[model samples]
Every structure is written in C-alpha cells, then in structure tokens.
Target: MAVVRSLRQYVEPVVFGAQMACSFFDTGLQMVVKQRSENATSPSDPHEDQNAIANFYMIFNMLTDFIPILPALILARIGDRGYRKVPIVVPLVGYSLSRALLLLVIWLEWRIEVMYVAPVIYGLCGGFSSYWAGVIALVSVSTSEEQRSLRIMRIELVYGIAGFLGSLASGHLFQLYTVGMKQGVLLASMSVALYVFCLLYATCVLQVSRITLERRESTSSGIITHNRQDRTIIALLFISGILYDVAVAGGVQILSVYVLNAPLEWSASEVGYGNAAGFLIFITSFLGMKFFTRFAVSDTSMIMIGMVSFMTGIYFMTFVTTTAMYFLARSVMLFALIPMPTIRSLLSKQVQGTSYGMTFICLQVSFTLASVATAPIYTKIYESTLDTYPGFVFTLSSIITFLSILPISVVGCRAAKQENYERIQGN
Candidate 1:
C-alpha cells in the first residue's frame, strides 16, 4: 500500500512531462513537413514560400489561441468546481487527435492546407491554454505556499528535460526509413503514441492533491476579497506577464521562419538541435531560481533579472548570421525562463486556495489575447523583411521585452510596501 501510494505521487508529473515531450516533438516535425511541402511546390523561390507558409502556420495558431478562450474558461470553471481531471484529460485527447490527423496527412500525401483543420479541432477540445492552466492550478493547490515556486519549478524541470530529449531525437526520427513509410510518418506516430499514453495515465492514475481539496473547502468563503493594494500589484503583474509572453511568443514564432531561410538554412537535424538549445533554457532557469532563492532573492527581482536576460539575448539575435551565433544567443537567454513561472508562483500566492483555477484562467486568457495581436504583426514583419532584414522581428521583440520591465518594477515596489506594512503590524 505504501509503495503504491508513493508511485501514485509521481504519476501527474510523469504524465505532464510526457505530454510536453510529445507536443514539442510534434511541433518540430510539423515545421519540417511544412517546410518540405513549401519547398516542393515553390522550388524556385523557397524563401518566399517559406514566408508564406510561416504566415499560414502562425495564422492557424492564432486562430486556435483565439477560438479556445470561451471553452477554456468553461473547462477551467469545471475543474475548479471539482472536476480537475476533465481539463487535463480532454486536452490530451484533443492533442492525440490532432497529431493523428498529421499522420493521415503524411501517409495520404494530403494537401498541406488540410493541416489547418487540426488546430480547430484542438481548440474545440480546450487547447493547450486550458490544459496548461489546469496543470498549474493543480501544482499550485497541491504545494504549500513557501515551497510553491520550487515545486512548480520541479514540474517545469521535468517538462524541459522531456522536451530536450524529445527534440534531440525528433529530427533523427523524421529521417527514419521503413518499407512503405513516408518521411516523418514515424515521428508523427511516435507523438500520437506518447499522447495516448499521457491521456491514459492522466485518466487512470492521476488524482487531485488531497491537500488542495482540503484547503479549498476550508478557504472557499474568504478567497475572493482582497484590499486595493494587492489588487493593484496583481493587475500590474498580469499586464507585465502578458506583455512578456507576447515578446516570447512572437520571437519564437519568427525564429522558426528565420532559421529556415536566408543565411542559415538549417536542416531537420539542426532545427532539432536548436530546439534542444531552447529547451535548455528551462533547465538553466530552474537552476538559477534555486541558486537565487538560496540567497533569498525576491520573486520580483528574479523576474526582473529574467526579463533583462531575455531582452539582451533577443537583441543579440537581431544580428545573428550563423548557426553558432544563434546558439550563442540562446545561451545568453538562459535565465529567460524564470519570469513566467515566477510570476505564476507569485500570482498563486496572492490569491486564496479556491481561486487557483480562476487565476490561471485569467493568465491563459491574457496569453490568448496577446497571441491574437502579436502573431499577425510578427508574421507581417517577417514577410515584409524577408528580402532586406528578416531578423528585424527579434529587434521588435527586444523592445517589447524592455517595455515589460516597467510593470514588474511597479509590482515589486508594491509588494515591498505590503511586506513592510505587515512587518510593522506584526510588532
């Protein structure tokens, strides 16, 4: 019984890691397929084709992000009302179905345009925004306040490690050969298999943290009311987090297009390696947080440090001409992963136990809204500058990231005032 209970404790994180790995692998493989299809059709002008395809891809992603807001809110409300697994399990099902559609596209040699349907299906099932919100809510409610950051980081570490391994192997998997098999079919199949496993584990093995349930019951009545100052700080923090996410999302979306064209025509293998480098950011940021917390750094300070690191790295990326330079830029952004998760931890701490799901829902909504605006803007910028300066998107990202710091500064000051006030009251 003891061993069984101990093993059960590991199931949620394992499932989360598996889901992340498969998602990243699927994303990388999808990019390769899109690139290949575009290349096959427009062999004379691969650069122009790449820009067009990238725009289509980002538009599809933006639609998925936009369409899911209502459904995500509904699912998150359900989860908060005691059906936590619904949000997680349903998204895994959607993910598996979407990946399976890609396999069909590969095997049947369907038009690349058919791929657009998959994101709509994914959105109907609540999409990644809902899934991640549910997972964060679970982590937030389960852990104690003091250890919440570390606990969330542990999940993030597993997610990063899984993505690292998946990305390292995904390119090689795309190159796999088998009798009567199309290129990338095997990789897509593997992604579907992993999603299936994740879905099953989440359905059968995962349980709500008992501590979370107890706290929710005990604190249900008092969770909604907060004084004006904390509310102001949280609002500023959310605004900052949303802007920062916009920079991150726009930068990553354009980076894919940038790497696939012009001076750096990376192969499938090289793309995987680049993605692995990106995944390493999570591991390094986790380590940075651990080290800084040991020295008693505040969450706001950690967030400021991370934003600075991201801005500097992105600024450097604007001038990257070679693969080595790209990787070097990624390395400089090692601490860039800190701000989002730390902001999440801080937000979770501000609210009462029963409000975790709602808080994360708002965060997801903010991200969705940011994506709606940023995706098309970045896509247009990349398309227009394809001839002259495709890397201009990174410069824009750095500017937006720099702007994100102002709200963080406001949040930090407000938090400090609250802390000092509590200290004085305690005396």
Candidate 2:
C-alpha cells in the first residue's frame, strides 16, 4: 500500500508512461532497429532497407509483447502472491538477458562483418524483451476500478504526448549529434548505450520495488470468474487494437515519408521531429476525458468513434502536401476515440483478478498481429502498380479500417443506450 501510494503520488501516469515513447529511430530507434535487423540479407539498396527493417522490427517487438500481455492480467489476478511474480518474473529475466546480448552486439558492431547478425540479434532481442504488458498489469493492481478506465486513457494519452515529445527531442538530438558529434556507425554506438540504459533501468526497478499485492487465499479466487461470458468489451478490444495499429502504421509511419518525399527530402531526424509534433495534439485525449468526459463515453465506443475520426483523418491526410497538414491529420488520429475511457472502465467491471492481465495481454497480441499484418494487408489489397497510386494504399487502409469498426460500433451503441436508459430510470 505504501509503495502503491508512493507511485501514484510521485509518478503521474503520463510522466512514467512517457519512457517508452521518449526515444525514436532518430535518437536511437533506427540504430536499435538496424542493429537488431543486421543479420538479414543485404538489400540491393541500403536506403530502401531502412524502412523495411524498421517495419520488420515491429514484427519482432510484437512477438515479444504477445507473451506478456495476457500474463499481465494473470499477474494482477494473482496480486502480490509470489506466483503472480513467477509468470512475469521468470520471463523478465529471459527477456533482459536477450536484450543485454543485443546491446552487446551493437556495441561490437558485429553487423559490419556478418551483416545478418543484426537481424538475428534484433529478432532475439525483440522476441525476448516484453516487460511492458506485465508492467501495465502490475500497475493495474495499484489502481481501483474507477481508475482502470482512466488508466487505459493514460496509456493512449501518454503515448501520444510522449511520442510527440520524443520526436521533438530526437530531432534536436540528431541535429546536434550529426552536426557536432558523429554520424552513421557512431550514431549506432550511441543507440547501443541507450538500450543498455533502458535494460539497466528495468532491472533496477524490478529489483528495488518493494510493492506486492495482497494475496487472496485460494487459486480459485484469482482465476477468471467471468465464465467466458461473451462481453462486448472483449470483442471491442480485439478489433480496436487491430485498427489502431493500421492507423498508426499507415497514418504515422507510411504517410510521414509520403508527405516528406512529396517535394523535399527530409532527413530521418527531421521526419522524426515532424511526427512528434503531430502526435503532441493527442494530449487532447487527456482533455477529452478530463473535461468532456462524454468524449470517451465507453471503451467499446472508443474503437468505433476513434475509427471514424481516424479514418477521416487519414483521408484528410492523403491530400495533405505540407508538414502542417500532416500534423493536422495526426491530431485527428490522436482524438478520434471518445469512447475509450468508458469502454476500459467497462472492462474493469467485467474482469477481476489475474484475468485483467490476460485480457490486456490479448489486446497486445491484437496490436501485434495488426502491426505485422500491415505490409501483407497492403500488398494483398493493391494492384502491382502500387507505385503509381500512392493514394491507393492509404485509401485501401481507410476502407478496411472503416469497415472493421461496424461490429464494435453496434455493440457499443447498444451498451451506451442501455446504460443511458438505466440512468433515466434511476432518476
């Protein structure tokens, strides 16, 4: 309780959560990705491989995240019991060991010799390091039911703000380093250091933390009591995660390059900075929930409502040629979902104990599949002459993303209406 109280008071969700979003390809993300992907066959051209490897890195990270997301629910279900820690703790060690090796590989610059070493290392490091979902699950133990919905909001909100700031920070860092410090391989060395820092910090936190959940008596108490009742919230999480990734990949990653390449060739760092500025507007999620609580009316509704805003935002983005227009498009991506808070809250109501960790983990899996599916989905949808129709890819994504929202929207609307009627009757 003391530790929980301390964390709640000292660590605002946004600040602590920002750690994941703070760095990017420019500051060190690219180097990390490259070092991670070094083992792959040399691309015919180095330039094209940059984007491709980065995309592939997402696949690796998704795999690592998949193992932990559900474990989060279980860990929370187990609470402070030593067993809760087992599922998460054992994996944490395995993950850390792999990450440490990745850092060592980068430090050695083994890619220069084997080339493919980076890719193999990337996969190994990526498939292993997955403390994020479990971290979320542990945090869940500290929060009350009322806070769970808001916690979901914080995850999205903080990522938006932190991602933006990191982009901005990376831009400045890149400019400073490239002009004054170092470039290319030297830059890769710096990223290796950063990874070490992240790994070290994670280890220290895990080691020092005295926090533990109060143990429930029996294993049955922690097991999911929901009886697999078909719930609207569960379905919505799965669907929303998929669409969210498509939106992120298409709107943020792919479109940034598209916009930048339109007239001027923005360097990687510049692109990173621009992306941060756009995501900063997602701070609106905080405002949406805090002031206009109606915006995030429900978790189930977030996917539906966010989808409409997101798809429209993407359509609006396709026509955008300027950096400012790109920002506008990304901002829409930030605030499209008003129903997320409500929906997450609904989830808290449904899931109890370690099950919360499992549910959240499942959502992570959804995001993973969605992120990995991007290239395949894009390739399958388009004609071979996709080069001629830059807009075709964006357009296809919009249509599919929009279509994906229908089922969730229906379930969410029904829930919202039922809740409204119940309120009226109480009055």
Candidate 3:
C-alpha cells in the first residue's frame, strides 16, 4: 500500500500510454500514406510514389513542428504560474482529438489531405512541446540536483519501453480488419482509445504540486548579478542541442519514407520492427548511463560519448543496403539516447526550479524552429537523390552530428575550469 501510494506521484503512466498510442498511430499513418500514394501513381515510377510520400511528410512535419510554438510558450508560462497540470492535460486533449481525426479519416475514406487540420487543432492545445516540457519541469523540481539526470533518464526509459512494445504490436494490429472496416481502422481506434486514457490519467490521477512562486521570485530577485560562466554554458548547451536535433530530426523524417521505397521495401510488420529497433536505444542508453555514473563519469563526457555513437551509426546508415546491415548500424548507436536528457538535466541545473517549464520549452521551441527550415530541405535533398543516392541526407546528418560536438567540447572545458576554481576558492 505504501509503495502504491508512493508511485501515485509519478507521470510515467501517462508517458507510457501516450507513447504507445503514438507508435500505433505512426505505423497506421505510414502504411495508409504508402497505399494511397501507390494507388495514385503508376508502379513503373516508384520514385514518384516515394516523392509523394516524402512531400506529404515534408508539410505534415513542418506543421507538427511549427504550429505549437506560441501555445506551448503560453502553456509553459501558465505552468510556471502554478497550474502544473494545465500544460500537460491540454496537450493530451489535443493528442486525443488529433488521433481521433485520423481514425475518422481511416473509417470514412476521407481524403488524406483532411488530416492537415489535425496538427492545427493539436498545436492550438499546446502539443508535444508543452506536454513534455511540463512533465520535465515537474520531475526537475521534485528531484535533487544530484539525482536529476538519472531521474530524467528514467522517464525517457519508460517512454522508450512503451514505444518499443507498441511498435512490436502495431504491425500486427494494422492488419486486423473486417469486411466493413478498413485495414487501419482497428489500429487507429486503438490509438484514439489509448490517448483518451492518457488524458484521463493526466487529468485525474497523475499527482504534482506547484513550485512556490514566492521562492522563485525571491531567488530571481536575490541573484543581482548572473554568473557569466553559467550564462555562457547555457548558451553553449542550446547551440549543441539545436544542432543535434536538426541532424536527428531531419535524418529520421526521411528515413521513415526511405524504408518504404525500393531495396528494403519494408512491409508493415518490418516497419514496425524497424521502429521498435530504434527505440531499443533508450533502454541501452539507460543501462549505459548507470554503468558510466557508477564510474563517476562527468555529464559532458557522457554526452560526448552519445554524440560519437550517433555520428558513427548515421554514417553507417549511408551504406545500408540489406536489412541486416540496417540493424547492425542501429546496434552501433546504443548510446545515442544519452545526449538530450542529459542536456536537459544540465539545463535544469542552470536555472531556478520555478523556471524549468519555460527554459525547457524554450529549448524545445528552438528545436521546432530549426526543424521548420531543415525538414523541407531534407525532403528536397531526398527527392533529388532518390534515384542516384537516396542516403545523402543520412550523410548530411552525420556531418551535422560531428559539428554539434564542438560546442559541447567548449562547454566541457568551461565547466571543468569553473569546478576547479570553486574547489580552490573553498580550500
């Protein structure tokens, strides 16, 4: 009973369920888009079908990344004002409604173009940017500074595990159909139902409390002079984060469409398995963190290790021709999940606890803004290289990943200097 009560304070349940729903929706939408595009284009021109799918995603992803910016900021402000759940609950509502729209499209045979409005309604309610930042803010304020990194990583681990399980089942679920129902109806309906569960869980069950505004204002007011080093570190962290995100997001956005094309030509089940393989990094990363932390590894060092892992893996991705080679490349990225959460943990340490929501949202919104330019550019690159060199975008991602490492190295040098100075001053 005590354990159950203790667990009641967590938001992991909502993360788990919502991620599961997202996995289902992702597979369903991908296969649906594939089918529709194939039906509209001649089989002789596979490149045209691939381009159509890529074009749909280029706009769809932009809307997903762009529309939520203002609402997310507003919701973050509200979260900082004391209503912690508002940021989370509102976005879950958007998630549920948007996923339900897909279900309608699947069941009624509406044109896929109708789905464009989904992100609009979703963005108005604050979207994933607000939702995740809210969750991180709550977790950051509740945990001690020393334990924050592990706590955040644990949350990410739960999110990944849920996605893995959902992806494993999604392919089989997508094939479930009756005479009157469409192929994806069951999967789409499951996504809607799970999102509704997440909404309810967030609304009524997930327990959180407001960080005291008086304390926050007092801390802010009391710090008359901001530390120059801390500000520099924050700026550096943001730069590293933005560059890494652009690489990962642009690469992933194209990879999804790439798998559905020739050479691999992955079926629904294969696609689900491939996504599930990607989520495995979360588990491996969590384990890697535990091992590294036990050895007293610095956060920046851990981040560098993760960055290198992704760099190598994405470079290898440029040469993937067989399914086995694809998995081998994925296996090389075992630590790729470490950088972002650890970066967030580092950012949380640099700010007052009360500003966690706003700071995290600023970082997320920055990622979204970068994606606005990079997503379309990646699609264009993919389209241009489809027949000759389809993996060019992956190679580009690897280059960006290497570039992201430079700012982080600067951060490591600055952080070490600050620590040594503080130690000498104390002595």
Best by lDDT: 3
**lDDT of each structure?**
0.81, 0.51, 0.90
TM-score of predicted structure 1: 0.95
lDDT of 1 at 302: 95
Q: Is candidate 2 or candidate 3 better by lDDT?
A: 3
Preferred candidate (lDDT higher): 1 or 2? 1
For this target, which candidate reaches the highest TM-score against the unseen true structure? 3
**TM-score for each model:** 0.95, 0.70, 0.96
Candidate 1 C-alpha lDDT tens digits along 199-283: 8888888777677577754553354354423678788889999999999999998887778776887887887888888888889
Clashes of each: 0, 32, 0
| Candidate 2 minimal-lDDT segment of 10 residues | 122-131
| lDDT accuracy of residue 272 in candidate 3 | 96
Off by over 4 Å in 3: 210-229
- Candidate 1 Cα outliers beyond 4 Å, as residue runs: 10-17, 20-28, 216-229
What's the TM for model 2?
Answer: 0.70
**Candidate 2 global CA lDDT score:** 0.51
